[model samples]
Each structure stands twice: as structure tokens, then as C-alpha cells.
Target: MTLIGENGHAADTLTGSGFDFGEEPNPYGAAGFPLDRRYSHSLYHDADAEPHTGTGSMENLGFGAQFPGHPPFRASESFGIAHPEPFIPEIPQAVPDSQARLSVGSVYRPSLGARGLPDLVPDPNYVQASTYVQRAHLYSLRCAAEEKCLASTAYAAETTDYDVRVLLRFPQRVKNQGTADFLPSQPRHSWQWHSCHQRYHSMAEFSHYDLLDVTSGRRVAEGHKASFCLEDTTCDFGHLKRYACTAHTQGLSPGCYDTYNADIDCQWIDITDVPPGNYILKVQVNPKYLVLESDFTNNVVRCHIHYTGRFVSASNCRISQS
Candidate 1:
């Protein structure tokens, strides 16, 4: 019997030499099946004894006789065709101890002025009599030793225009509390360390600071130049090295709170026209998930602020659940 395929080729053909089809067994095995000796010799020695051609034996095609007392045989059940092994995904490994970890340290409001420079008086044209001037808000944060393995490497030629770029050399694969793997691979152009203020900056949206009206839940002010010094031990406005992570050692030194400098303009939002009331100051580090961290939930700091026309006070600031 010959079977033809759609492409005008012989799909399969049965010849007298291929199989017996007789009810009786051949010299090799019962029911026209080849015995072990013939099967092994044909399988290992004879290249022409292809299984698909039936030269190897019809039993290799899952056709076999059942015993007298046993239940009828099924090729799918015996050959595991219907029931396959369950799929199990490969588990991701954990990140090593020596990696960069960034978190918000403190949240406070500073008097409206630049550090080491005179405060700018509100312009008479911009400030109304009923308005109060607001200065730059500060967030003190640290890059611990376990999470401080950043190195400054030259970016690819395509990104030479980017003045600042750092590589997170030893980033770890971390799974979130939900058991989902977060870090897949290292980023090409990951972070930017600004030298003037000793802070790491990124174009990512999550790297900015947002000031919201606690009562209304409305964002009244926002600062995008979220830079911090890796050397400062305290949140004091001192002149520190601007860009720290040149080699691995010079990176944000472990166990330090590189706080914001008042000298930068984008550090504060002008709330002079905002009505005097209670507000919430929320600061988020690495607002975007660009960099990998051991814990992402600790990146946000929430503080209660009391805003009167004359004075602005912040209290009860703590890390909020991410």
C-alpha cells in the first residue's frame, strides 16, 4: 500500500519486506514483532533499518499484542504519550551580599535658601501678599556596603554624549515578596552620578521627590534633581565630593547618608501661593525600577508636615510601604 503526500511525494509505503501483517509471529518475535537480537542489530548496526520505515519492526510504532487476562493495551498509556511530566520552571538564584542597595534615610524641610549662598527673596511679581515662600525639601539616604558595588565605566560609543553613566557591575537576581523575579539582566546605561553634589541621578521618573498636600492628596510641588552625596555621614548641608562612584571603592561609601544640598534649584518646590494647611511630604528613592535593590518597599519616606504662613515644620517622617 502506498500513500502520497500533498507535495506529490511518497509519504509512506508498505512492502512485503517491511512487515508481515500476518496474525502469526515471524522468526524474530510473536505477532510480527522483532526479537531483542534482531531489534538491537537493526537499531545499532543497520543504518537502513529506520524506525519510520517499519524495517525496525511494527512494535517500535507502538503496536503490540495484549496478554490473555490483562486489559486491552493502549499505545498512549504504555508509551506516556497522553501523560507527560509536569513543567517546572528554573528557579532564579539570589543576589550576592556585595551589591548596591539604596534606601531613603530621612525626610526634612529646610529653610528656603541655597547652602553656602544667600537666600533668594521671593520676587514681588511672583509672590502675592497672602502667599508664603517654601524652600527645598531634603531626603537623606544611604547606599550600604552590601549594596554599594557600583563602578564607573565608559558607556558605549553610541552613548558618548551622556556626560554621566555608571555600571552596576555585580547586581543580584532578587525575587520580590510575591515570588516574582525582578532583576533579569544588567542594564546598559544604568545610573548617572552628578559630581557637583555627590549624588546619583537618573532620567527615570521614580528618581524625583514629590510634595503632596496631605489633606487633599494632591501633589503641590515636585523636585527632579534628586542628588545625594555618598560621603556625608549626616544630613548636614556641607560641601562634599560631587560624583563618588568612580571606581568600586570611591562609590557611595557604605553606612553613610548622602543628603541633598540646598544649593541645587530642583531640590525644592515653590509653595508660596499654596494655602497654609497640614501636608504630607513623600520622598521616594529610585522612583523607577531601573536599578535592582534588595528591598524596594523601603525606598519611600512619608512625613507629616505642618505648614503655617510663617513657619514650615516636618514631623513623624518614616519609611512607608512601597
Candidate 2:
């Protein structure tokens, strides 16, 4: 027996050699009738064999007992039926650090995908490693090659014993480089930095923390306070371009009016002509005595500092004439 598919090719074929001559009646009784009763004596019987011996008829063309073998199921070595899901790389946490003189270290570069196959999935684990800005670049465009940048971490410091850790998150494409619009319009860029500037104990003073530069190893700015657009007029309301401040607040202990508090001040000093290098940021806080509280005998002086900011980058050092 032979069966042809819709494409006019032999789909299945069966011959006398493929069937067993000594087989019993069909157990399923197909075609709405019992096999033994339907064919009666017409069904072949093995006369030269044992009494129980029975056989199938070769006279029927469409009733062959065997079916053709199926082709082997094979899979592709590369992307098979369902194309392989794109491979998304993880963003490394250990990026370069910041430096003094307002210049930050360059961002750690990420690895690329296969030469032909590109990664297409959006990274699920994304974080703002650090928030940094350059100082020299902030004040004067002066020497384009010798400008400073600053950066801060996302975590804030509540007590004196806390080091904020920020993760770096880079844009798919840089501002002035290859594949201009490759990155999404709204990339995962913005991050928050912890800030604290208040009176400690009975002193009416403020406190601050500093972010060091990656290349110069100098303090870039204190905490996250270095990046902002605050007041304009100073003294007699004079205009000041770049400035950093520490917020001052007064504290009270109920019952007795607390009149004393300590002040905090975090400062930044810019440096010039520094070699680029990767660095880490560590915070140090020192308490200063201010107004005396009601209980003057016991001086309440304690400084709190926190390290924040992710990896930062400065303009490339190579000077190019416009």
C-alpha cells in the first residue's frame, strides 16, 4: 500500500515483506465490524503451521499491516525553530573613582556583544553607581583639557559611621560620540544622593562630607551638595556663579529650651595639571563646638560624614584644536 502527500510525493509505503504472515484478527475491529466475522474464510490461515497459526491476506491492497518509518527529528546547532534569546550583559559595579580639582575618573567601559549577534534585551538590574560633576568645567571653560568634574553616590549618611556606595550607570551612547541616537531618549541616568547638615548635641552649627576626585585623589565636593542651582545674591545680594553650602538647623530637647548646636562645613579645593588615575572615596567627619547647651559641662560635639557618588568622567585629556 502507498500513500501520497498533498505535494504528490510518496508519504508512506507498505509491501508484503513488511507484514507478518502469521498474525491474528485486528483487536480494534476497525470499519464497524469484527475482523474474523467480516472476512470469514477469505482471511488467510496457516495450513502447514500449528493449529493456533493465523495469517493476514495479501490480496487486499489497502490493508497492509506495516507503516513506513518516520524521518529522524533533527535540531539546529545555532538558533533553531525558536531563535535563541539575546544575551544581555550585566553592568559591572567596580567602575573608576572620582578625584580632586573637580575632575572625575573616566567611567569603566562595558564589554560588547558577539561580532555578528547583538544584545537586544534591556538590562533588568540597573543602578546609579555614583553622581559626579567636574569643578573646573563648572566654573570657567578656561583650559578645556584641564577642567575638573565632581560626582556623588546615591546612598546618604545618617550617622558618623556610614560609607555610601553608588553604582555606575552609563548611557548606551555618550553625548558627543559614536551612534548618536542609539540610546533611548530617557536613559536610566538620574540618581539621588543622601545629604545631612544639621546641629549635633547642643551646638548650633552645621556639618558636611566630601567626594574626592578620581584622578587627582583630591576631594571633588562634599556629599551631593556640590551639584545644585541655589541662591544668586550674596552679602549685599551680589551674584556668585559657583558655590557649595551646608544646611544648618536648630534642635530642641523639649522641657528645657536647647540653645546650643554645632555647625558643619564641607569645603572643596580645586587643583590643576593633575595626572588621570582611578581612586576611591572615603569620608571623614570632625565635630566642632558651637553655642553651649543648658548642660554646658557635657560638651556635645560629633561630626557625621558619608561617601556618595558613582564613577565620573572628565573631558578626554588629548587637546584638539577647534
Candidate 3:
């Protein structure tokens, strides 16, 4: 894909994971918005282009090589030129009621543990916990997201927009918060289900971790922890807390943030066979675009690590758009 920058020039070749830059939605919709869930499918490549002699295209009646007085015209060409303004899928400068800005706080408490630690994943639902015990190396860290999306950025220009929707039995009654705007819908999500805790856990794929070898440019380790319980664990800001998972609702309200302590079950990435060297430990939240957030960027947090056979040290931590 070609990348153009704000300066109207080609940007430098970038590397790493791809991010959702709030591009225009596909033209497959015929509804409230292009990305709206209730969109009707349109004829794509199956339809042929309009021929020159078709109804408003040009004169279709029998005509000579040249007209007598003037060229044939149509009412559709009243402007003589067709200029449609480009749609910029920009995040609204003012905050929307239902817009949830997802972000990762930090990937702290990196630790190395042996494979198959006792009681690491004791399932209460009788579901097998093999996914946690199978990892050879464990490099666990914490991942969090906050609803203070509007507060994170001072300038609206830096924020990438999010167009989110969900499949529900009653969509008309459930609008995009206060506005009349409606979003496109997708498959229903229980967020996630964890057998270990025995209840619906975090939003599915809400957070994930990875350890990569910087020198070889190869993935050395993968984190087993992804499903996280979305709740208001803590909030340092002054905004009022409005959401709670205890009420059987799943979401992070403004000024609220949720965290999975680094020592949680299956929270580490396996890095057993990797040789000691420089590596990057990447942690991300909302990896699957499951939530309608204020910003798509700031979902990734990466840190540089130097790992010997016995020890690992993380430094130079930074955040970027996924």
C-alpha cells in the first residue's frame, strides 16, 4: 500500500505491524454510513461500466457523424464538471458518548519461569488448562486500556478514528450513544470466555504479548495471555467512574482503566529455544478491533530487551499505533 503523509509527500519506508489509519470504508454499503452494520450489499465488479450511449451518458437516438447545431447534452451534466469531495474518516474532534479509546498502559514485571508451573491454570469450569502449561518460557507483563481517549490527545489531528459496531437483536433502540448515527454491525461477541476463572472474561483478544529477536528479525516467543476481563480496576484521573463489570456490563468508562497483573495465568510469552541476545517485547491491547474506540493508534507498547541465558532486562519502552 502507498503511504502519504500529512505534508502531502511520501513518508519514509516504515516497518513493523500495520495500523488502522481511519481510511474510508469500503463501498459495499448502502445504508446510514458506509461502515454501518445494516448496510445492503451492492453490485461490485459484477456490474459493467456505463456505456457512452447509455441514458444520461450521451445521445442514444440515431445520429450522424456530426450534429447539425450543437452536441447532444443531458440534464445530469448541469455542472459540466463532476467533483465529489473526498470523505475523510476523521475522528470527531469533540468526544462522542459511546466512543471507547483503547490503549495499552505498560508491559511491566517481566519474569522468566519454567514450563508447567503448578497451579498456574487451575480451571474451575473443568476445562483443560493445557494452553498455559505448554509454554516453555514465560515472560509476563501487564496490559491495560482506558476510556480517557478524548483526554489523551490535545490535538484532534493526531488521533486515528474508530468506526465500531456490534450485532444485536435490537439495533434501532441502541444507537451510537446519544447521536442519531448508527454503526455497522459485526458478529456478536461475549468479549471472551475463560475457563480458569469460570466466567466471561476480558474482551476477546483484548491484549496480547510477543517477544521478538531484533537481530534476526524473527519472533522468538508468543504470549498465551490474550483474553482479559474488562473492568474498572483503577483510575488516576478525576473523571467520574461510570462502568463496572459487576453489573453484568462490559466496558471501560472514561477515567477508568483495567489491568491484568503480570503474574496472572498464561500471562507470559514462551521463549525457550531462543538464544540469549537482543529482543523486542511487544504488548498490545484490543488486537482484534473488537471495541469501538476513539483512537486506533496507541494500541501497541514495545520495549527493548537484553536477554542472557538466565536473565532478561527491558528498557527503552515506547508506544505507537498498531
Candidate 4:
């Protein structure tokens, strides 16, 4: 499906959903400094689009390494996160997980359909792919030039394995929290650097997407968009953006959102094989239930999709239980 924005260009096609909106005044924040300060620095560093997947054991360490004890936290420009403590807490033991309510926003960006044909990537190559925001204009031009590449190349109608690409803006929202939003300590966790993304990304996979048959309820296609950088890009309840996923901190304050837009590489499912018809597009945040939440019922969202031989349309989007 070709989605032409009001300006005729694809809707925010080449832009990764990022937070540069400047800090929204946080009334709940510390007096002098607005960026809420609770945790210490992150122990690991991400370099060249790769972050440390190291989950250091928090077994023996200072009180700060355990629950209730917070340490110094800082975000690095070149690196990613810096934490003072040696040990970091686990996901289940995370204080915020108890109160933090995670919600998956409806699909945003034009990728809601099949506008991501060019966003498709073969396996193995996806590991080094970069978000469109980090790529050059030439890449978009290349995709535009190859608009017909699908018909000529691997994605012929006879091809059943080609990925039906779609650029997506899956917004991860922090609707509520115990005392704060979903704040995971940087130390126990790890951040990887994406040189192409030119930023820090959570070492964990945050959200997973799948397309299921409406008739049989069978999964036909799926994709895993990384949880992405922790930031408070937009807010709702409190109307104040708190956590920016910046230095000395990382999280999504209540009413705040963390966006993983369609511009990121490989943000679509393999739909070429999916028979043209109606299906349920399902997206779930915290699919593993790794991060404890107050309400798991609201963690899933589904939409009705109609796919003809060549194009697809989405409707009846609703938030539901997985």
C-alpha cells in the first residue's frame, strides 16, 4: 500500500520516532533539577550500534545494588548509560515494575498498511540495519526508484516467503507506575550503542508484533521491534514529560511515551506468503511478561486488516488482552 502524506511524501517514512522535544516541566521532579533522579549510573556501555547484553549477577554487592537502595545514574553522549553500583536489580525485583503500567499504543506511521515494501530486509542483513533517521536521503531515493522492484525481484505474487514490509510507530506508553514509571536500573540492565542510530538502545526486546488469521486465529507473520531507547517522548495523564531516557536516568514516567517508529529497519512482518484476505493484526508490549506490570490485560492491541492481492488496509483497531 502506498501512503502519501499531505505533502505527497510517505508519512514520516524516513524518521525514527525519537525524543528531542526538550524537557516538559516536571512538577514531581527534584527542585533544582527536573529530570527525576532515583537510580545511579549504568554500568555497561554500548558501542557502534551494539550494547552489552550482560546481565551481571546482583547477588553480592552494596545495599545500593539491592532493592530500596538507589545509586548515581548518568547518560553518556558517546557511550550510553553509566551507573555507579556494581550490581543491578532484576526485572521482577524492580520497584517500578510493581506499579508501572505498560500500554501499547495503536499503530502509528503510514506503515499501518503495506507501505513498507522498501523497508524489507533479508535475514542476517537485518542485524546491521539502521533506522531510516540515521540513513541518507539516497536510501529513500533508492526505495522510490525501486518502487517496482517488488514486481521484478523476489516479491512476485508467486513468492510466498517475501516480507510484507510496513513502517510502524509502535508507541510504548507508561500509563501508571508504583511511585514512578517503568524505570529499570541501567546497571543490572545494559545499553547498546547503534552507531547508525547514533544513540542508546535498551538491550532488551521491548515489543513484538504478529499478524493472525481472523477466521482460524493462526499466526501468519510476526516481527520484533526492539524496545528502543527509554524516553518520555510524549505525555498524557500528568501532561508533564518526565523521563527523557537521558543521563543519570532511563524510563517512561506515567503519561509519558517511548516511540519505536517505522523508520527503524526491518519493522515489518513477512506477509508475502499471507493469503489475501481479512486478518487480525496483533501487537503486544512486554510479551514475555518479563517486566512485572500492574495490569497485564491492557498490554495487547489488535486491529482488523483487509489484504487484497497487492494492497492492505487496517481498521477496527482496539486495545485488548493478548
Candidate 5:
């Protein structure tokens, strides 16, 4: 008996009697097809139908029934039908929100003989003095995401060489801060000497402070080091006390501030020679932009200062838009 497929193509010629279509297991639908779950039986023969001369086998007829639009199947040739690759939807990853907000807290001139001040050993090339202006700096950082901000320094030694560098194995990314807008027109090489030096000594990262002449817009003196310490008061000024070096090895936690006391070394800009005049004390955090932040605009604070040849004072100190 000759059987025609649903597509009106001669599917197979059967030569057997009492062939039971209902009892035969469906090989094409054993795993199931992409188009439908039910198998097609359009090419199957009735159990009571008489047999006829056939050139193809039942396996060959099964292909045409499995896929209606597919080409005809042959008994002698090996079947190698191509199928469309499986569909896989792509998923997007979430980005982290890391913000490092730095601001200047207070600006003042310590007594000529403050205990915590560093001794100025006079150098023939440079004039030194005992009087300087100290500014309390604050760093308020937060990681809104679930990940923690982590970083470390590692030292590696080879047979003939050695190297030391900061490593950001976790989410924390920190770097040395500088004067972001101290001298905009001047080349970095010309201003490199004024950069904080104490940061180079410690394996940890630090921020920088600058005393800028608001009138001339020139940086007169700058603090060489801004320590990352714990504050007795919160960033929001809930209490008032002092900051001390505490977490020397770990990064600042999210929603926290690393406050450095104004009495710390390199916390003052020598004003012994600076003429008495109005000035702006600018403090910036993460000035190098080595670490990623959600917002950079809030990294600076400015304080207006009134100076006399005999005494110096700061007023109107607040977070600046610039």
C-alpha cells in the first residue's frame, strides 16, 4: 500500500500485512519537537490494510512525518538533517554605586609651639618656619551595593628584582589624593613638587590639602600628608572632639568617614612666610581620580580665611560647589 504525507508527497510504499500503527512507539516524538508535543500520524497505515511493493522502509517514512516541511527521506542514504541552534537569552549584570565624598571640616592656625607639629629642620635651599595653618579633613564614602570596598598592598621579590604595589582584589579602589584645581594652567611637572610627600612613605592611600590665595588663585602652601583615621565625631557633626589613627590596614567602611585630626603631621601648610591676606583653603579627596566614584563634584571644600601679620583666623568654611 502506498502512503502519502500531509504535504502531498509520496512518503513510503509498505509491503506487509497487519501493521499496527497504534502499537508502534513514536521515535520522532520520544524527546519531543520544537514545533509541537504530539507526533504526526498522517503517513501511518491502517492495521487491516493489505501490503504492497515498497522501495523505502518505515524509518525513512518517519522523518517526513516528524517534520512536515522537511525534504523527502530515502532508505539507502544516511540522514543528517540540520537543526536551528537553541535559543539562549542573555542576562545583564548590575553595576555598583561607589561614592567618595571629601570635605574640609575646620581651618585654623595652631600655636607656634604645638606638640604634635613636625619640627622644621632649616635647609639652606628652603626657608623654614614654625607657624602653619591646619585643616581638619573628612572622607565620607559608601558602597550602595552588596559588595564591600576592599584593597591591599603586596610585595613581590624575584631572584633579581623586587616590587611593591596596591592590589584591588575586592571592590575597594583607593589612591593618593592631590590638589585637583591648584594650578589649572600650569603643567603637572611644574606643580609636582607641591604634591604631598608623606603619602609616598605609607603603603596606604591618603588625601591632600592646599592653601590657595582666593585673589591670586595660586597655591601658597599645601599639606604633604592627610591621614585616614577615626574621628571622635561623626561626619555629620553630631559630636565634636578629635580624630586619631585607628584602622591602618583596612579601607573605610561604607557609610563611614575616615577623619584625620588637624594636629597630625603634614596636616598644616606653613604660612610663616605667607603675607597676611585673605585666602581660600581647599581640601580634595581622591584627587588623582585613581579610584571610581559615583560623584566627583562633592569631593572639595573651601574655607575663607582672614590673616594678619601677627595672627591668622578662618571663617565661612563650608563645602563648595566647585
Candidate 6:
């Protein structure tokens, strides 16, 4: 295939021949073809020329084009645009809600372990347990102080911007916690599941999981309200009046949500009660969990919640402790 130039001229016809970026001087116009003016670069091909390589490309035969096979090409290990392979399949961002989220197969071992052991072995340190999408929708709600309920009482509907912060606890060790104490400088490579991920070469397959301020599409505040609810729910964040936990993961515990090991984690977000005006509730996914694809169920999970009302505390609600 030959690359046609912007001048309505065929720069060079392929006779198993190569490309020439130089101007087409005295270019030939076919019988009914329009005359070729000096070829101007189109947006797609404007930036110099991409190096082309095929069975007959100059680079294949030792000539570099401006791009991959650029001409005057010093085979310098210098900089140049990197092209993607011809057919990298597109991974869908969203999968059906009810679809099976896991790869189907037995945990097969390829090689025999110390005398052909075939039975599944559990890691004594496996810590038995375990654990633990979407452009979130935003909503705005208004409030005014009806009466001073008390210090611990719900804030009367006095209108103020409700700020929100989302936190995702991971199953991995948390710092200063009694069990599974994690150090601040702990290397990411230390976790078993994480190590398994490295073994599979599937890290890039996941989406960039991060905490997002869904309304503003920004980072969430560390420990304060950053968004407001749009639905007509009393805006409260207090532990007693505002929140409740899901008995979903291993009965109780805190960590990012996961589909395996049966342990549960928690996500906490603070919502504000603003003075009656349209506002956007931002539920930013904690950045730590945003890109994880290991847990497929979470991939299709909508993170759906009906803003029942405002809660007072930034801390997650507990069911087991209750």
C-alpha cells in the first residue's frame, strides 16, 4: 500500500519500493486526477512521518524512516513515538452485573511439589481469611436549622456546603493495628495476593482505581466532607443517626471491598448538608482501590446507594460491634 500525499498526489507507488518524505517534484497527475500541489500534512499525519515497517520496509532492510523507520535515521537508542502492536484487544471498562466475574478453572498446578504433591496446600500464614466503578452520581441537598437538637443531636438544617471524604480500607496490614501491623515503608511487593498478581502479568489489565471526587472529578479530602447529596435525604454523618455497615465481607472488619476470602472492608465518605441549593454529591473512590481488577465483582459493582440522609461521623458504621 502506498501513502498518498496531501497534494492529491501519490508520493510513491509501492512496487515493493520504499517511502520518500521529500517533496514530490514535478509530480505526475493521472488522467482524471487533480494536479498535485505541494503536499501539506494533515492532522493525523502532520507530525513528521511515522516510521512504517513491513516485509518491504526500509528498516526491515536496514533503512530507518522518520518514525520507527524514519530516514537519515541514526539507529540511536534515542527517543521516538512508540507504536502499539497491531491488534491489542480492547478490554471493556464495564461488564454485565450478573455475569460470572471470575475465570473458571480449578487451581491447577503445573509442576509436582516436592515428590508430586497434588493436593491443595494452605499457607499456615495464609491469615485465613480474608476479605474483603463507575462515575459515581452526584446529588445536592439543602438544609436549615429547625432547632438546636444538642451537641450530639443532628445539626439543624442550617445550610452549609456538605463536604465528603471517601476512605477504602484494604485487607493488607494497616499501620499500628494490633493484628497485621503494616509499616509505613512496607514495600508493595510483600503481600501474597499482590505477589500473585505480579506472577500473572495482569496488573495492567486493571483500571486505574483511585479515590475520586465524583462530583468535581478530583481527589477527595483526607478527613472532611467534600460533597453533598442531591437526593432528598436528611444529611447526617453521625455514627448513631447517620450510618450503618453491611454484613457483607467476612462478617466484619475494615478494608477495601474484595470478592475473595470472605473478609469485609469498609469505605467511608462524608456528605454535607448545604443551604438549599442544587449541589453535587461526590463519592470519590479511594485511590487505593480504584485500579484493582483482581476482584472482578467490584469491577461491575455500581457502588449504588440511596442517600437516606446525612450522617455525622466520617468513620464507617459498624454492624458486628453494634
Stretches of candidate 6 off by over 4 Å are 1-55, 58-266, 272-278, 283-322
Q: Write the per-residue lDDT of candidate 1 for residues 1-322, one digit (tens) a residue.
A: 0111321121111111344537643322212323332112211233333332212322333545222222333347656564433333211111111211212211011112211111101111111112223332111111311122111122224433323321100001111121112221233256565554454543333234456878688887554433332222332243333234332222222222333333233334444345678877665554554443333445555666667756666566655654
lDDT of 1 at 247: 24
Which 10-residue span in candidate 5 carries the lowest summed lDDT?
117-126
lDDT by residue for model 4 (1-322), tens: 0122331232233222233324532111111111111221111011222321444324423234434345446677678877564434432112111122222211122211211111100111121122121122223423322322111333345534323333322332333432335655245246665555455556355666777989899987776655446666666664677666543466666545565544444344545445678878776666664444434455566777777756666666666656
True-structure RMSD, every candidate: 26.0, 32.5, 21.9, 20.9, 29.9, 23.4
Name the lDDT value of residue 85 in candidate 5: 37
Return the top candidate by lDDT.
Answer: 4
Return the clash pairs for model 3, or none.
19-322, 36-184, 37-184, 37-185, 100-293, 191-204, 202-228, 202-229, 206-286
Estimate the TM-score for candidate 6: 0.19
lDDT of 2 by residue, 58-93 (tens): 223244442222222435567565443333322111
Error of 2 at 19 (Å): 99
Candidate 5 residue runs with Cα over 4 Å from true position: 1-205, 226-248
**Residues 100-166 of candidate 5: C-alpha lDDT, one tens digit per residue:** 1112211111212221211101111111122234322111111100011111111113311122111
| Cα lDDT over the full model 5 | 0.31
In angstroms, the error of model 1 at 246 is 6.1
Candidate 3 per-residue lDDT over residues 32-145, each given as its tens digit: 111211110110121223322322211212232333223344444666664543332221121111221212211011011211100011111111111122222111111211
Prediction 2 global C-alpha lDDT: 0.21
lDDT values for all models = 0.33, 0.21, 0.34, 0.43, 0.31, 0.20
Q: Residue 112 error for model 2, in Å? A: 65
Residue 192 shift from truth in candidate 3, angstroms: 5.6
lDDT for model 4, please. Answer: 0.43
Return the top candidate by TM-score: 4
The parts of candidate 2 lying over 4 Å away from their true place are 1-129, 135-205, 208-273, 286-322
Quickly count the clashes in candidate 2.
Answer: 49
